[model samples]
Target chain A: MTPPSGPRKGRPRNADADGAILAATREALAELGWGGLTMGDVAVRAGVAKTTLYRRWPSKNELVVAAVAEQLDELEMADLGSLRADIEAVVAQFASLLSAPETQAALLALFAEATRDPLLRRRVREAIIEPQKRLVLAGRAAAQSRGELPLDTCEETASAAVDIIFDTVAGTVVHRMLVSGEPATPDWISSFATLLLAPLAGIGAGT
Target chain B: MTPPSGPRKGRPRNADADGAILAATREALAELGWGGLTMGDVAVRAGVAKTTLYRRWPSKNELVVAAVAEQLDELEMADLGSLRADIEAVVAQFASLLSAPETQAALLALFAEATRDPLLRRRVREAIIEPQKRLVLAGRAAAQSRGELPLDTCEETASAAVDIIFDTVAGTVVHRMLVSGEPATPDWISSFATLLLAPLAGIGAGT
Candidate 1:
C-alpha cells in the first residue's frame, strides 16, 4: 500500500503526529480542564512544535473536539440478540463514558463554549454526537425487523421515532450522570429498561 | 406578611436590596459569563456597594446559583388533567427556558464551573436541579391517582421510577435544546409524549 502523493513537495505529513497530539490533548484536558488547557502545553506534551500544533488544529476547541470524537468512535453498536439488551448495553456504555472524569470535564466545558459559538457547537454535534446517534437508528431498525416495533408506514414517522428515542436514551443517561449526580448502576439500568421497552415490546408478537 | 427580625441590622436590611443584587448578578452573568463576572462589577450594576453584595452572598458561585434558582422558580407544574399533557407542558416550559440566550449561557457556565467544585455542584443541585425535579414527583402522584399508573409495589420501586422519569423528561429536553441545538417544537413534543406515556399506561391497566 503506497502512500498517495501529496499536492505539496517535502516530507509527507506525519500521520502518527496527529495521534500523538490528540492523545496529549485528552491528557491535558484531564489535568487542566478546558479553561486551563493551552495549545503550547499540548504541543510540549506531544513533543511537537507549537507552530506544528497550530497548523494542524488551528484552535484549542477544534483540537479538543477531534480528541473527544476519537474516543466516541469506540461507542459501537452490538447485536446482543434483543433490542432491550442492545439499548441497555449502549446506555451502560454511555453512562461509563460520561462518568469518566476526563470526558465529563471536556464535554461540559465544550458545551459551555458552544452556547456562544455556533461553529464549535456544530463541530461537537458532527464529530461527537452524530456518530452515537447512528447507533440508535441501527438499533431501531433491528427492532423493527424483529417485530419489536410496528413498521412505519411513512418516512416521517420513522425519522420522528429515531429522534425521540435518541433524545430519551441519551438524554436520560446524561441527566442521570451529570445533572443528577447518580451512578447508572445495574439496578437503575434495569428499571429504566423496563419503562422504556415495556410498551414497545408489548406491541410485539407475544402480546 | 411580617418579615423575620434579624439579629442586628441597619434599617432591617432592606428587602429590595436582595432582589436588586440577584438581578444584577444575572445581568452580569449574561454580559460577562462565569469567567468574567465579578462581585465588584455586580455591585456596580446593582447600585450597591461591593461589601454589601459580599455580605449577602459570599461567593460568585453562590450568588449565581441564587439568581438562577429564582428563574427556575417560574417552572411550576401544571395540572393539565392527563399525565401526557402535563409532561408535554413541562417539557415545553423547560425547552423555552433553556432556549433563552441568557439562561442558556448562565446554565452552561454554571455547569462547567460546578464540575470541579463540589460545593458549587451541591448548590446547583439544591437550588436549580432539585426544585424542578419536584414536578416529576407531582406528575407521578397525579398520574397514580387518575389510574394512569400503578401504585408502586414498594418504596424502592417508586423512588426508582421517579428518578428515571425525571431524568428522561428533563434530560431529553435539555439535550435537544442544548446539545443537539434543535427546537423542541409541538410536533416533537407530541412524538415524545406518545412514547413516554404509552408504556406507563400499559403498566397501569396491566395491558
Candidate 2:
C-alpha cells in the first residue's frame, strides 16, 4: 500500500528512490567506511543524481542516521513465553544486527563523529537511540501481563526503569561485540539473559 | 623506580619521552579528532623528532592504544566496605574517564577503526579491554570476602560471570554517557548499582 500523500509537497516523493538511497548509504559504509564514503559515491551507487541525494538528505550525518535508523527499526520484541526467553530473543536479534559489517562500520563512526557535532548527536539520539527503547517498554508490558513482573505504579519511576534497562541491554551487547571483540554467541546470550532477568523483574518494586 | 633495567637491544628507552608522546597523542585527539590526528603532528606537539616517535610506536593505532591503556590503568576498585558502594564508586570513575574530551574523542574512534583492522583489534583487546576486566575480578573478590557474594566452585563459571558483569557495567555506563547523550549522574549510578546488585550476587549460584 502506498503512503498517503501529504500537503505542501512539490512532487510526490519517490518511496523507491528513498529506499535505494538508504540502501546505497549502508552499502557505501560497509565498503568504504565513514571516512571514505561521499555523497557522489552514494548517489552513483543508488543510481540517482547528486541533486536528488542532496534534496533528500542535507548531509552525510543525516543520511547515515536515516539508514541506520531504518535497520534499527527491525528490532522487535515478541512474547516468547517468559521474560528470559523474550530477553534472549531480542538480545540475539540485536547481536545479529550489530554483527553486520555495515552496522559495525557505521555505528561507532557516527558516534565518534557525534561527539564533535551536537547536531549529529541529536540526530543519532532521535533517530536511532530513542526508537530502540520501545523494545524495553514492550518487553516490560509483556512480562507484566504474564505476571512475570509487577505493574509499575509511578510514571516517573517506570520511565527511569526503562532508561536503565535500555542502557544495560544495548550497552552490554555493543561493548561485548564492538569493544571486547567477542561474538555474542548463543552461550553468551543465555548467560547475559540469566544475569538480567532477576533485576529486570525486580525493577520498580523498590530499587 | 629507575634502578631496574630490562635486557634488550639499543639504548635504554626514555620514560619521559614515552609519557610526553602519549600525553600529546591524547591532547591531539581532543583537538583534532581521530581523522585529523597525524604522527608528525603528535611528534611536534610532544617536542620529539619524527624518528623518535616512529621508534616508540609504529603506527597511530598503537600510539592511541598505549595512551588509552595508560588512562584505563588508572581505573582501580577500592574495597569500599560493601559491594554496592564498590560498584557505584567504580562506575562513577569509569564514567568520569569517559566524560573527558580526550577519552571521549579517542575511544570510540579507536574501536571503530579496529573493526576493520585485525591487528589493531588484537592490540585493543590486549591493552585496553583485558586489563579492565581485573577491576571486575577485584570487585568480585572483595564482595565474596565480605560474604556479600557466594564463592563459586567452578573456574569456568566464575570466568563467565566476570565477563558478564564487566560487559554489563562498562557497557551500561558507556551507552548512557556516550550513546544516549546523558550524564551518568550520582542518582543514575546509585540506581544502576541497585539494579545490578541482586543479579551480581546470584551470578554463579545457579543461573
Candidate 3:
C-alpha cells in the first residue's frame, strides 16, 4: 500500500518497511509487551528514521491501533441457511483468529495496554472491538429476520454471546499455549463451534 | 472479633479498627482507584500503625482480597415460587458483589494482577471464581429438580452463561465508568436474565 502522504527524504522509503514494522510490532508484543515497546525500537527495527516515524504518526497509540486493526481479520459472516450455521461459522472464524500466532501476539499486547492506558483502551475498542461487535449483532439480526433465531435476541445479548464464545476459545487456546507451549490445532475450531452454539437452539440461548 | 493470634497491640487494637480499615479501603478504591491508592495513605486515614495494618494483611494484594471477601455475602438457593425468582435472586446477589465499591476495586486489581502473577491468577480462579460458579450450577440444578428447568440443561452451559453474564457486565460497566465516570447500575440484569432464558425456551417464550 502506498503511503497516504508523498515522501521526500535522503532516500525513497523502502516498499517493504510497513511489513517489517508490523512484524516487529507483533514480535515485540509477544516478547516485551506493549509497555516495553518504544518508538525508537520500532523505528530501528523497521529501518525507518525517528523523524520519519514521528511524521507519519503522532503517537505510539495511533501506530499500534493501525497495526492491530490491519492485522486482526474481521469475521466472514457467511449466510449458511440456518442461524446455527451463521453463528457457528462466525465463531469458528474467531477461533481461527485467536489461534493465529501473529494476531494472538498483537491482541495480547493490546490487552496489556488496555489495563494501564485509557487512551490506548479507547483506541483498541474503537479499532478492534466496535466493528466486531457490529458484525456479531448484524449476524444475529439476520438470523432472527429469517425466522431461524429467536426474535428476542437483542444486540447487546448477541454482543455478550460473542464475548462468551470467543473469550472461552481464546482463553482455552491461550491456556494450551501457555501451559504446554503448544500450537492450537484446526480441530479445536470445529469442537469450539459446536460447543459454543449449544445454547443457541432449543431453550438454552439466553446468554 | 479478637486478634487472631497476637499479643495485645497498641491502644487495645480498637474494636472498630478493622471496620474502619475496610471502610477506608472502599472509600479509597471508589475515589482513587486501585492503582492510585497507597498503604501509607490508608494507614493515616484509618488512624492505625503501619505495622498493625501489615499485621492484618501482609501485602496490598492480601488486604484488597480480604476487603473484597468481607463485602461478599454468600447467596442461598432457597426454593422460590418460580425458577426465575431463584435465578434472579442469585444474580442480584452476585451483582451486588461486583457493584459494591470495595469488591469492584479488589476485582479490578485482581484482574490486573492476573496478567503477570501466575500465583495470584490461579488463586483468583480457584478461590474466588470457582465457588461462585458452583453456586450457579447448584442453583440451576435446584431449578431442574423442581421441574422449573429442563433436565437436559447442562450444568456447564449454565455455568458458562453465568460467567459471561457477570464478565460482560463487569467489562461494559468498567468501560462506561472509565470513559464517562458514571456508576454501573443493576438495571441491565433484569433484561439480561430474561433474555438468557429466552434462547433456552425458543419461540414458545415469545418476546
DockQ comparison, 2 vs 3, better candidate: 2
- Candidate 2 residue lDDT tens string, B68-130: 888888888988988888988999999999999888878877887777677878988888898
Scored on chain A only, each candidate's TM-score is: 0.89, 0.88, 0.69
lDDT of each: 0.79, 0.83, 0.57
lDDT per residue as tens, model 1, B38-95: 7889889889899987777767777788888888799878889888889889888888
A49-150: candidate 1 lDDT, tens digit per residue: 999887777677788888888877878778787887887898889888888866776777777777767787778888788788799888888887887777
C-alpha RMSD for every candidate: 4.1, 4.8, 6.9
In model 3, what are the clashing residue pairs, if there are any?
A203-B200, A203-B201, A204-B200, A205-B199, A205-B200, A206-B196
Index of the highest-lDDT prediction: 2
Model 3 CAPRI rating: incorrect
Q: Give one digit per residue, the lDDT tens place, for model 2 in A43-137.
A: 99999998888787777778888888888889889888888888989999999999998888788878877776777788889888998899999
**Per-residue lDDT tens digits of candidate 3, residues B20-137?**
8877876676555555578888887788887778877777766766565566535455667666666567656655555555555455554444434456556556556555555656
Model 3 residue A66 lDDT score: 75
- DockQ numbers for every candidate? 0.48, 0.48, 0.09
